[model samples]
Target: MLTAPVRTMILMVRHAEVHNPKDIVYGRLPGFGLSPRGEIQAERVARFLSARNADVIYTSPLLRARQTASVIAGQSNTATVRRSKSLIEVLTGYQGSPNSILVGGFSFYTPVKREGDESMDDVLRRMTNFLSLVIKRHAGEEVIAVSHADPIAILRLGLEGKPLTVENLHSVVYPERVSINQIVLGPDHVPQLTYFDVVRSMETAA
Candidate 1:
């Protein structure tokens, strides 16, 4: 006999724009908050999720992601947002200088140097571990997770069984300003991405 599959909905969202005008490549850097437009975007995202019934709201420890989650939770009338360091953005290989390159729309490519930061493999590990924990915690409920760009892409790749190499990082598209990716977690402990890069409408009247 085959075991029944667990039914859970995971909404993975990338945080709104940041306040970095110099484009200093603030990978996992502190003191980076959302821009003014990002605040509006976050509010719009909150309205988007207000229509859905979310059991729990989770956010990355990063300030921008946490702020985004807070706004959404407030709109949805959620009591509190859970913060997880595991959901943080990938640590970059470069610090002060802007070494990260944007490619093919929302895809980003960062060349690895000896004096930089974490590798692509490290990012994959962090993303997989965080997703595994989330799947185990919410077996049969809908959960929302707000995080950064690279990690979200990494998680999607992991769920799709794609290789986590530098070349293949661009396979998944990171949604702009509160885009949602829906994933279903089954009993086999694997997540299947149902939809990705869903643009939410800003108007509340709809």
Candidate 2:
């Protein structure tokens, strides 16, 4: 239980590298896990989180996200992981295309807006709501939400007061990059960015 003036924080984590040998956009279709090196990346992230205090973790139902959450939470206490639909990947009608959404990003979304896919605004709304709820619930505690690139990126951009366009989405957070976006919520429930850092991995350095 938190005492007076509880502090709340949440770490937004993008899932590690995925098994995309076929080079197709995975979207929310299913059946994708982390690559071998991606597992290493996950391990590094886990180690990184192990050095901090993560009271609870929330993950998208996607396997890659769940796996990443499991690895990180595994470094700490047990059974504190929960799945939230709001943390799922960007809804896309372009899952099976040879070109990934990262390549064209928001441009591909133009053709599928009427196909019932979620727009950038939709993702921002869902992610922001989810984040607010978690912060309020876990006041005075630290949490990690293992999510897809788009959702995490959208939330970061939204926090920074930027448009949720796909411009530079890939550059903001690379696939399986060891970056973490942290938001510290003040008592008024306003989130302040502590840091949006890309942790350099040993593989990337050497």
Candidate 3:
């Protein structure tokens, strides 16, 4: 007898903008939180998630991600907000450099992979592992995960069978600040990108 597919719904969100007036690359750096505009963005996304009826929310240990998750939990009525290191930001060697340095590297034929920086493959592994556990735990429930830009892009690209290259990562339209990337996984564990919504200045993010 054919069994029904075990569908798992996940809303993968990128945390809102940081309060980085200096415009430096804050990779795995502490003391950075959401800016005023970012708070607004998070609020909009949170209100949007309010109607999603998500069961739980998993966020990165970073302050910005946690803040976003907190807002979502309060607004969406999602009771549980768990912090997962797997959702943390990508480890980059250029943490203290100007943001332009990293952004410019993307357009290069092969982006500079610093010696101490975390490999994209490693990122994919940890992210996928966390997702596996969530899928098993939640089963049929809808959930949310608030993470950073690089990690989020890497996970989505890895799941979608796209190349994990700097060019590809840069070319792919990333989930903007406080945006949602709706994904659905079937029993086969293959994820499908159902929708990508950017929370604009609208009263409601939906």
Candidate 4:
């Protein structure tokens, strides 16, 4: 029997810019929140998704992701932000450093097998697993998941069946672009991305 197409809009929102005046790597470092401009960007995202009628907002426990989710939910006057462990930042081998050359290494096949780090495939697994639960929870509804750049990129690449390299992380959405990725889930519990977008702005991100 031919099955009908099921639509579940999952707006993948990258957290707003951070308050890093010193320009530290700040990769998963605790206590970093949105910058002044980032707050503006969060407002823009909240406004952008205002029409989404979001059922529930999911966010990483990280301050930035949680802040973004709260702004969207507060502005939309709906959906209280929920801390989802699956939506948390990807664990990396590297902790904190200025040099980006040999920082946290990302993998697509095997787990990085380092201290507190995850492979790209691991990220893909958790991200997809989280999405599956969201689809099941809000079948036929729009939901928002706010997370970091690399994790979001991993999920997008995996959904398209594309391999991930260090460079592939560039395919992620910019901060506050309010990218809406419409995901369709099959009965077999697989999420197929039918639409993906990032609202690029000509002006500098505010």
Candidate with maximal TM-score: 3
lDDT of the candidates, in the order given: 0.73, 0.76, 0.80, 0.70
Per-residue accuracy of model 1 over 78-188 as CA lDDT, tens digit each:
436898887888665454566355434432335554444666667777766766676677667788999877778777776677787666676566556678888777666
Backbone Cα, N, C clashes tallied per candidate: 3, 1, 0, 1
CA RMSD of all predictions: 3.7, 3.8, 3.4, 4.3
Q: How high is each candidate's TM-score?
A: 0.83, 0.85, 0.88, 0.79
RMSD of 1: 3.7
Global fold similarity of model 2 (TM-score): 0.85
Clashing pairs in 1: 6-187, 93-116, 93-117
Q: Please give, for residues 72-172, the per-residue lDDT of candidate 2 as tens digits.
A: 98898643999999999988777787754445344645566447888878888999888767756777788898888768877777777766665755455
Ranking by TM-score: 3, 2, 1, 4
lDDT of 2 at 100: 40
Residues 81-131, model 3: lDDT tens digits: 999999999887668777787545552124445765678887888888877
lDDT of 2: 0.76
Output the better candidate (1/3) by lDDT: 3
